[model samples]
Target: MSDQLDIDYTRRNKKPRSLGDSERAKLEEFIEAIHYSARYSDNDFEYRHVQLPKQMLKVIPKEYFDGARGTLKLLWEEEWRALGITQSLGWEHYEVHEPEPHILLFKRPINYQPPTH
Candidate 1:
């Protein structure tokens, strides 16, 4: 598949900017959910829908629906690497029994390694 990362995230020498508070909160929630799936499942991959809290939901409101929000936050490969994720796949790639039609299925082997900073 073609790389979907923004050109900005593609710059190796560029100093990645910090995510805003709201975005950070969302990512943290996502991290928890993703980690749960990864640790519990025996499969080589795991997936989770972004379930922002009601309070945080108000902040992002109509910007995105469930898994779509997760996809946006994880669109960049750099972000993927930071999360110890090997391959990230979306609805366009495959479907699962998720509540939302959209879902993010990620591939990380049982003996996976994260990228060194």
Candidate 2:
């Protein structure tokens, strides 16, 4: 169950950088499809195959998908779940925000240090 094959997505400033136009588009499409499926379908736990393209994967870093060992099927499932929760709620007037432009950005806490001479 090692996620040793996943990628890193963090930057030095501890902020996730914005995903490029193409990657963002693909990710949004992927998330939207899955979210809608989970929200509208009777089978919420159905297994689905969402293929993220190589170009989109290349823009993202290496750490985001490399953690958490468990029942999740894909490296990005956790993220998809987080984003799709609202859809599952069945809110009548709710406005589901599009996935963030930087969906692949990773934020890991780190101690800040100043350079010394």
lDDT leader: 1
Q: How much is the lDDT of residue 85 in candidate 2?
A: 22
lDDT of 2 at 114: 32
Worst 10 residues of 1 by lDDT: 4-13
lDDT of 2 by residue, 2-86 (tens): 1221323231213333345664554554443332222222222212223233344443434433233211112233343333323
Candidate 1 scores a C-alpha RMSD against the true structure in Å of: 8.7
State the C-alpha lDDT per candidate.
0.35, 0.29
Compose the digit string of candidate 1's lDDT tens values, residues 28-48.
544444322333335543334
Listed in order, each prediction's TM-score against the native is 0.31, 0.26
Instruction: Give each model's clash number.
Output: 0, 5
**Residue pairs clashing, model 2:** 7-62, 7-63, 8-61, 8-62, 8-63
